[model samples]
Target: MHSYSRLHHQSGHAAILFSLFIPVLFGIFTLGTDGARAIQDKARLLEAVEVASLAVAGQGSDNVDLAKQYLEYYFPAATIQDSDIQIKKINCEDNDRCQDNESRFFEYQVTAKISQPTWFPGNEAIIGFGDAYDVASRSVTRKYHSETVDVILVADFSASMYNRWNGGSKRKFLDLKDIIVVIADELDSFNGYMADKSLKNKLGIVGFDYYTSRYNNNTRYFYSHLICGSNEKECTKTNPGGSTNSVNYSATVRDIFNLNSIAHTPWQKREVTNISSFEDVLLTDDMASLKTKINSNSFNITSGSGSGTAFYAGLIRGAQMIYQQGENPRQLIIVLSDGEESNKNTTQKLIQAGLCKTIFDKLNSQQQSNGDNVKARIFAVGFDYNVNNNPQLADCVGAENVFQAQNRDDIKNKILELITEEIGHLAQ
Candidate 1:
């Protein structure tokens, strides 16, 4: 009986020990799982805050309330009470305290915190103590207005331009609008002066197409009648609005849309009148209006691929415009098209036959000239069914200048990359 009682006592002690250890093991397991979840939540919140802050800074929103609203949209579950965001704009000169350039770079810092309640006895008790939980994440972006670019858009509105490029869902007309809106918005970034007094660049546009019915002056380039009003008078009695001589845009892109229009005259009377300057208008707005017009007019791609695709003709005209300015400014030609140049001789058999190749080769040689100091880089975007097959059109703007996109997103990204790279080059 004494031995049996001693054995029973040992067994009871062992059972008690196991019971104590069971809770400790279970507590540890639960803590690990819950801790992982808390960490994930914290990381997600930090990312959300960072993105929100960037959006606020990019939009140039001064109202704190709007920022808060934007934050909620990005992080639907995260409360502003749990996060702190601070924004600072430092001059490029003051960036490293070197005071080298006056460009402004905005820095945004976001700090977020959240607490999770513990349920286990030890952890639950510690919740009342100072040991809740904490995690951190960080991201940085630099913003500056360091350079200005005056762009001359040369769009291709030729007969062969009928294409369904955006995944067989969008026609050329629709896609062009999408491209314009994006480029214009990017161009608007040029404030010329940043918060830190850095210089932001400006953009200009020149869209071209066939509308070449009248050309009396036969001037290589003619100022838009839209700018100064009636061609008959220097300045019209009507408020001629803004001049379309230099249309401003924010982003870098190709010019396929030509705003050149023939004077509205009857076909019979056309011979009687001697035309001076056939106005090739593009845009007239300085800021938001330009952006709005691009968005509005993009979808309105006119029918009838008139005259023909004057690929190099447009380039020559654009280059001349830059020359007429008399200032040695940085010039870039963005050619967005299918790259098929029409044989003008087919339409006018008696006209000069070899002009296209002659003109094209001259421009090509000039672009490749080693002594040319003017920064003129051309970016040719092609939507060819087979990129390798279409060498002439794609190669017009130079090999380095060519960019082929598969979709709208790809096109947008490539354009942004090109513009950013050019800006970096200018900074140097």
Candidate 2:
């Protein structure tokens, strides 16, 4: 009877231990499953905040309300608390907020938190912790700032650019001219809004054409400089409240460099030709000079000569000018091409595209000795010419960034999107 009683006592102890372990084991199971699910939800929450930050920064200053909308659109499953989101605008002068030199102008800061019920029984039975888990994230983006930027327009002056017979009704060069002015105006306006005028974004122009050698080697021809006869005046430009007046003088077909005389004639009695190859103007903030380079009569005189780019030289030339500035300001290389006939082979075209990409990679991803990829973004525009069999261009500058505008109106709209979405986008 004593032995039986001892066994019953041991059995009672085992039953109590088993009951205690059941809740502890139950907590462990819930922690493993629900904890992992919470981690995944946290990641989704972070993605929502990141995307919303960019959209709010790019769109405007409406703030937390706008960000919530973006969050709902991007992450509908997230459960947000009323007090869990914050958006703030930062000014560089406020050293407390804009501590880093990179955030030198205006900034948009976004913060978000996701809260959901916790399935872990430990919260109620043992730990007395809250019945929910909070997953939170934050993102900061720059808006207009005091950043100095240099914009280079790498334009195509190929003979094809002078034609209208291919699906296009207007001369491609003229259409390109309208596009150039629009871009310049947008950039200038960006500069105008800057609190510091010295931080003006500069503009530079490059006109490129393909040149073939006697050995059949083809190279890009850059309009390096412009000149005028001792007696003739510079071409007048068409601007607001400005009337244009020009004297008709003989046009000359000089050698590629204008070093040797080839032929002389007059086209509708326009300005004298002192244009030559390899005379690209460096970056400048002067609008009149930029307009003159585009409006000059010789600028439009594209006869049956010149077809030189493997597609990268113009970009390289433009980038070189930016490097010369020494300010390490933000840089943008705007490539303009109808299409190139010289790069006829698919492999050949992609090779040229690779060279262009290398230059772009270098220019956009400039690094300090410590290896901070300045994290700059680049955009490219592709206007449709009569013969744009050069779809290879989409590969040149990411397909999304390339705007294949069919008409003048489309060109303006594309420019608007480029300015709005990507130009000053410094988000990482």
* TM-score on alpha carbons, each prediction: 0.46, 0.48
Residue 345 displacement in candidate 2 (angstroms) = 3.3
Model 2 segments beyond 4 Å from truth?
Answer: 1-146, 165-169, 211-279, 304-310, 326-328, 346-354, 365-378, 385-388, 420-428
What is model 2's C-alpha RMSD? 13.1
Cα-lDDT of candidate 2: 0.55
What lDDT tens digits, residue by residue, belong to model 2 across residues 24-113? 777777777778878887787778877887776675343576688877775565577557889876655654554445334457778888
Q: How does model 2 score by TM-score?
A: 0.48
Best prediction by lDDT = 2
Candidate lDDT scores, in order, read 0.45, 0.55
Model 1 CA deviation exceeding 4 Å by range: 1-8, 33-140, 162-189, 192-331, 339-376, 382-417, 424-428
Separately for all candidates shown, the number of backbone clashes (residues 3 or more apart, or on different chains) is: 22, 11
RMSD of 1: 13.2
Cα displacement (Å) at residue 16, model 1: 5.7
